[model samples]
Target: MSFEHEKQVCNLFHNSMEIIGRRWTGAILVSLMDGPKRFNEFHNMIPEISSRLLTERLKEIEDYGLVTRTVLSDRPIQVIYALTEKGAELQPILQLIGNWAARWDSKPNIEENTTEKVLNI
Candidate 1:
């Protein structure tokens, strides 16, 4: 490929990595791959993340036009978050990554290891 085409590809990959590489961002996006979710649902899906961090990541993704936030007019005023078309496009890519991890990741049980270490069990 020409140098200019290579540069453009590099830039596109970098920008995508910048968004997905943020802590908890990938997990958040993966959680939403099934459908829309409420704030608490995210917490349930990714229990390791704090509430404030989840809020921040959600706002950041929303700003990037990857997610759409809608406030429901219910009595308690619920808020729902869903992937936009741009974000939905990531589902297959994320699935491919998951497949790769399953096949090659050396520490697939890292979370279990960490928990065992923490509990000294």
Candidate 2:
């Protein structure tokens, strides 16, 4: 492939990573794979995430057109978040990553090994 084509591919990959590689973004997307969920539901699904961070991440993804935020008009108002088609397309990719991690991440820490090698060198 031409250098220009490789550069374009690298740029696209970087942009894609910037979106899904953010902390908690993948988990948030994975949680919504089931269906639309209310704010509290997200909190329950990802208990370690702070309410503040969750709200921020939701707004970020919503802005990126990856998610839709719907406000329900009930006695007590509720907001639901769901993945858009663009976001839903990531399901298979995310699943494949999950599978790969499950298979390899359980092994000895590659980072530690690399660090040791570097120190010895």
Candidate 3:
């Protein structure tokens, strides 16, 4: 390949990584793959993540136009977060990654892992 093409590919990969490479971002995205969820739901699904960090990552993901935030009308105003068409498009990519990880895992029984159940890998 030409040097210019190689440079463009590298830049594209780096730029995409800048968004997904952040801690907890991938998990957040993967969680939403199933369906829309409230803020508290995200915390519950990803227990290891602190509220502050999840909030930050959610805002960043929303800013990237990957996720949408909706405020619902109810007695206590509810806010729901869901993947945009752009974000939903990442499902196949994430599933592919999950499959790759399963193959490389040293553990003999990946089926028993909670992440496999969560990610539906």
Best by TM-score: 3
* Candidate 3, 5-91: lDDT as tens digits: 999999999988899879999999999988999999988889999989998999999999999999999969999999999999988
Q: Please give the TM-score that candidate 1 achieves against the real structure.
A: 0.84
User: In candidate 2, what residue range of length 10 has the lowest lDDT sum?
Assistant: 112-121
- The deviation in Å at residue 65 for candidate 2 is 1.3
Off by over 4 Å in 3: 107-115
**Of the pair 2 and 3, which is ahead by TM-score?**
3
Worst 10 residues of 3 by lDDT: 109-118
Instruction: Return the candidate ranking by lDDT, descending.
Output: 3, 1, 2
Candidate 2 per-residue lDDT over residues 44-117, each given as its tens digit: 87899999999999999999889999999996999999999999998888877765565567566545443223
How does residue 29 of candidate 1 score in lDDT?
Answer: 90
lDDT of 1 by residue, 1-121 (tens): 9999999999999998998889999889988887899999998879999999999999999999999999999999999999999999987777766665555668756453442232222
Q: Please give each candidate's TM-score.
A: 0.84, 0.84, 0.85
Which pairs of residues collide in candidate 3?
none
- Hey, what RMSD does candidate 2 come out at? 8.9
Candidate number achieving the greatest lDDT relative to the actual structure: 3
